[model samples]
Target: MRSLAPQREETAMHDHRTLGRELDLFDTDPLIGSGLPYWLPDGATVRHTLEEYVRDVERRAGYHHVYSPVLGKRELYEISGHWTHYSDDMFPPMDVGSDQVVLRPSLCPHHALIFRARPRSHRDLPLRIAELGGMYRSELSGVLGGLTRVRSIHLNDAHVFCTPDQVADEATAALDLIRRAHTAMGITPVRHRLSLPAPGGKYVDDPDLWRRSTALLTEVLDRSGLPYETAEGEAAFYGPKIDVQIADRAGRQTTLSTVQVDLHQPQRFDLHHIGPDGARHRPVMIHRSIIGSVERAVAHLIEQHGGAFPAWLAPTQIAVLPVTPDQHDHARALVRRCADLGLRAHLSDARRGTLGARIRQARLVPYQAVLGAREVGDDHLALRLRDGRRLDPAPADQVLAHVKDLVGAHRTDLW
Candidate 1:
């Protein structure tokens, strides 16, 4: 079994809470709520960057993106089994006249209703619906800390509906997507678990459905040549799932991505599709979350790289510093040019601090472009990286091109 405790390390200097406060990434207001956090401009930029990347990846994987409300009618969760199974974790409902509605804790039930909106045919066997929607949960105040454990969550959630014959292929594709995303984010999976039902009645009461789903998931993982452990009683109430636990730089394992094969929700919601034989048949639902929660991913990444983000995802990619007030115009012009090239750049003028102090401040950014009298007169730039490596005078075009290349290629370093 994997332990939930974080490994002891001398990480106080690089703690996410400290970096978040110092860099002005996010803040929590007690008047607002204990577990709720407000993202500052810098933090929002990082989250928006991640959201765009995930959306593009999902689009390429043939997913149809959709948006749903954060509040749902009480009946919705009742039918989906959340009212009975997850009542303790959900927020209290508000009485809306004769009806009651509550903030949604998950997006799967809402997506299920969308699938039931219209009739589908075998041609639309694998209908993949995706969303980056916010969810609310009533977390205990004592356990709330930073972005990792919050009451509000924004998830990259998707649900796939397919025929029984298409289950294996869809499962394989979902796992592949998870692997690709984690690899790109520089995360390593330390363990995999094939979660199954146990003797407790916490799961949906269907022995045959449980056996079939477990067998199918096992077969899919075995055929894909992926090694995993069988974890009994760890499955969701409606399905068996495949979970990949990723280890951070501090050797802490957190399960952020999952692929579940659900055999209960479709039947509860009466979701169906017409087969080639022109008869009504129930569809199987596959719930997959590649990056899981945006807040959690950002928290993990902050600790992973110690707040020095990758070039492509950094809020401020470059900081331009002029040696003195005389060269302020040149610094501004370079900043504009960097912006034109689709880079996030800022000018560190003398008003903020001295050139030396500004250079030290630029450590929060990825690259620093130093402009002096000699370079300005020569129409060149003196580059100093965050790592304190100084580059000789280089032509304007050459430097800009290199910066653009690094950003485009998602390089972690300026070199």
Candidate 2:
């Protein structure tokens, strides 16, 4: 329980997993391994929105996205030191007949190899490579919870290869990206922790390298003026890192983003770039993630908003409901119009029940378009919001404009 925002004295009436079931978001089945979850249509919609958002952010930050195999050779981890230091958390290696491989627990090693695949110059310094990398870990069943703790994970991971001089700037840029991403999603990182290696610890045993990396990170954080706490013996085995802690509405702070500075991996992988003086120099590596994983971020969001996602991120932004079977044609027409306008809209057939019942059920959708005789005849939409606010009927173009504004602004409120 790190210092976080104040929690409401009133308890949350519904947990995320329960809301997830009600909303048809995601579920876990014993048939499918213990910690794995199946993302239903609604859940996949949210996950896709998250993935698209991170990819766009990374792209704007000059990151090159790549896709790699989920499984890697066991020797790859041996070179990266995960074999010695992190094997306990990794799944057992699979025997592929003359070759042994394991589902990658992280994307750092693979990105290191990508950086080393070609000859690079000092001009190529600050190469930022990113991916929505899928990873697997062997956590004990007892510790597994819904989406928060699972065997499979899809990480918004990136690695920056830069010269020693560029470490501070690169790290600061990564911090900016993290801040922008969280702000876009209406999440606030309560504080940052500078995780450092403990003395005589299991971390990479190079004291000089540790001192250099830690000092560089401190300088960057100081320059940025972001207050942070230093935690002893909390550094990753490879290097020091900055962990961004986000507090949910319940006042529980979780580390959902990280910016780590690593100097050893380049040496381990023999990565090099030609410097200004025409000499080969090893590059420093920065590992970062804006959103650690799709599952955890969405889980936190589900609970934070209580299943009422923002207009732009909602699975169904607008629900179209007709008054009777005769009005179905009008409802269907409006659904098509909304789709053409780039809105996620679905038709909730009025044959199901009364307007009150449909409105109640459409609470899951951000906006409900009630198409009765007058609305259909006038080519207007009767909009009802999840917050129980009803809007006057507006022409099709007017409604489209409002929804576009919400989507463009990524607004959480109904207009």
Candidate 3:
């Protein structure tokens, strides 16, 4: 029995499929193909909430949101150096008359074209563009997990174009944004890694530029007081990058976000802006993603919270259960009140199962459940918090007010 205890505990902690089934969050259908997710209704709500959060954050940071097509002409990749450098990661190109089209693996080149849509001056330097864009990559079929690795990803992608003088400041500001996002989501602080190119490898082939870029990134980390590991030769072909890694409950580290400085892309794309001296000069590019992808972030959140989402982010903030058929009307009214207060709530009919069974089911998925009943002549609701605390019978308005505060305050874990 003692030896069996450890195995049972391990099974309880690492069982993601159990959480997925219990919460009715997501599932994959064979008919839909592998590496694809069929998001259940509740799962879609969670995804949308994350998207809104990122979009709002980006807007406040002075980033102009833009939309680009999922497919691009083959020639675009040719000029962007992706064809030669990252061909293995891209999806197969499609023949459309004389032009070949391929699904966009990244948004940099498309955003560059947007920058060139019109002429720009030094005033337009430090232009930040953001996109909650969907991209496709031909990932190896065997490596695909639920949401961690997917063929289609709605990336919280952004790029900043700025002058040489503004590089450090822009990088710092981007880091600040990412920190705020992680803090809000209750994600653990991540270890930063400074990713540089390997010596004598397929880097940008400019040693001076690599050294300068690495120095700038190192300075930013120092000024921010962020502890980081420097990985030699791990940089992208175009620039040095900062990879933010977070540890899961099992202590496996995964990259939650990244910020990269690119000095090569602007030159490759011939991107330039009018300088203060009225001359066309190249602009540097910085690419960043706070959460990386909506799907993967959702998966991480589930694992982090052990499938018990915070009130604000939960698909169903509160579940109302009636103790008897006589209390069904009161429970329904309570659900309506929750909805009016902008909380997601539902009423579970008492006829379905025993009170203990219903409570156990709700608690297993781990949502906050309320039990309404009539002990005396008047009506009241009992609050069962996710953390196992039970509140005395309270009036509907009082109950609604408390739940509203909990959700608004983002107190999902505490309750």
Q: Which has the better lDDT: candidate 2, or candidate 3?
A: 2
Candidate 1 per-residue lDDT, tens place, 1-415, comes to: 7554543444665667777877888889889898788999999989998898889889999999999999999999999998988888899999999999999999999999999998899999799999999999899988888887899999999999999889999989999998887766766778889988789657788999998888888878998899899888789889899988876556667778999999899999999999999999999999999998998888877877778888778889988888888889988888899989988998887777888898888886878888889888988977887777888888987898898997776566667
For model 3, where is the 10-residue window of minimal lDDT? 364-373
The runs of at least 3 residues in candidate 3 whose Cα sits more than 4 Å from the true structure, single-residue gaps closed, are 1-18, 200-202, 364-382, 392-395, 409-415
CA deviation > 4 Å runs, candidate 2:
1-12, 248-250
Each prediction's whole-model lDDT (CA): 0.87, 0.87, 0.81
lDDT of 2 by residue, 311-331 (tens): 878999999888888899988
TM-score to native of every candidate shown: 0.93, 0.94, 0.91
For residue 4, model 3's alpha carbon misses the true position, in angstroms, by 10
The local distance difference test score of model 3 is 0.81
Quote the lDDT for 265 in model 2.
90
Query: What lDDT tens digits, residue by residue, belong to model 3 across residues 257-276?
Result: 88998877787889999998
RMSD of 2: 3.0
Clashing pairs in 2: none
Candidate 1: regions farther than 4 A off:
1-9, 248-250
lDDT score for candidate 2 against the true structure = 0.87
